[model samples]
Target: MYEIVAGIDKSEDRGRAIAESITEMPLDHGEVRVTLLHDFQDNPEGASVDQVASVRHARKILEEVGIEVVLEESSGEPADAILRLADEQDAEMIVVAGRKRTPTGKVLFGSVTQSVILGTDRPVLVCSGDEN
Candidate 1:
């Protein structure tokens, strides 16, 4: 069975959609392990804690599909956290939602998707938020 680790942000819809897509893929008699990861950005004003709701919702969805989930919280860069978790889990594939950014934003902050792709030897599946 191949372990599938999904990197989730605060977007509940995107997280659920990615989980569903992974569930639908043909496993060829293998099992799937779903992991929900969140990198909580530090907010001195306590605004970032609101991501708890999204993480909880994601856990519920995966559980409904009979997929065991490993939920973790990290205080670091999102890309770094995801890569570290994938490695720790010995995940064969890493899935994350693809988000579009303005050219200026892309230039200032390089794409996490690109970074993950370049950094890891394992296959990276990027699900476009617009895709079904």
Candidate 2:
């Protein structure tokens, strides 16, 4: 079975974008499995991965298309958690949502998406968070 680990943040738009991109793939219903991963750097409320809004949105979309979905939570740096989880899951690919940032902005604020792409040897799929 083909395996994919998707790292998603709290943005609903990013989740939707990721889901839509996955749905566009021409895989059979049961041929692939997707793991939705959320890294909680700080969670005072003690929320689970499934409780994340973006994760939930992505889960619904993926489930509707008959794809197997797993929700996993990690607590630490997002890129590190994502890479660790992807390795643990032995995923064939990694998926992440990208934010629109200027070069200066990226320089000021390091991007999790950028980190994931640079840190992984496996294939990485990046989906845009913007609607348009």
Candidate 3:
């Protein structure tokens, strides 16, 4: 039962690339239980239209590789929400994507990806958003 937790932003611009990078990672022939999680709720009662679109896009990518997935949405701190889900699922890996930020900017306003990496002992696979 190999499980993975992936955190993503459902932005119109770069969400597809992030999802593609995660599913296209080199695999050693094991089926994955992928949880495609998006924490894009200010009031997390149900899936927003954009969140639904993000999940739909992500599912197609993972399914192409024969990996089954479930979509989940959460409200609250994005980084904390991701960690909680990973811990609950006992995930083997955590995948997150982010753009390159300046040191000053990072220090002033810490990033969700950075926070997740530092907060957990699990292996974090960071997919940079600058990829073409």
Each prediction's RMSD over C-alphas, in Å, is 3.1, 1.2, 2.7
Off by over 4 Å in 3: 12-14, 28-30, 41-46, 49-51
TM-scores of the candidates are 0.81, 0.95, 0.82
Model 1 ranges with Cα > 4 A deviation: 28-30, 43-51, 130-132
- Lowest summed lDDT over 10 consecutive residues: which window, candidate 3? 10-19
Residue 8 of model 2 has an lDDT of 88
Question: lDDT-based ranking, best first?
Answer: 2, 3, 1
lDDT of 1 at 126: 89
lDDT of 2 by residue, 10-106 (tens): 9999999998899888878588899999889889999898889999999999999999999999888999988998899899999999999899999
Q: Which is the better candidate, 2 or 3, if ranked by TM-score? A: 2
Q: What overall lDDT, based on C-alpha atoms, would model 2 receive against the true structure?
A: 0.91
Q: What tens digits encode model 3's per-residue C-alpha lDDT throughout 5-108?
A: 88877652345665677667776424778787888656546656344665677677777778877787787788998899999999999888877889999999
Of the candidates shown, which would achieve the greatest TM-score relative to the real structure? 2
- Candidate 1 structure quality by residue, lDDT tens digits, 11-33: 76777667766776777423667
Best by lDDT: 2
- Cα displacement (angstroms), candidate 1, residue 9, comes to 0.7
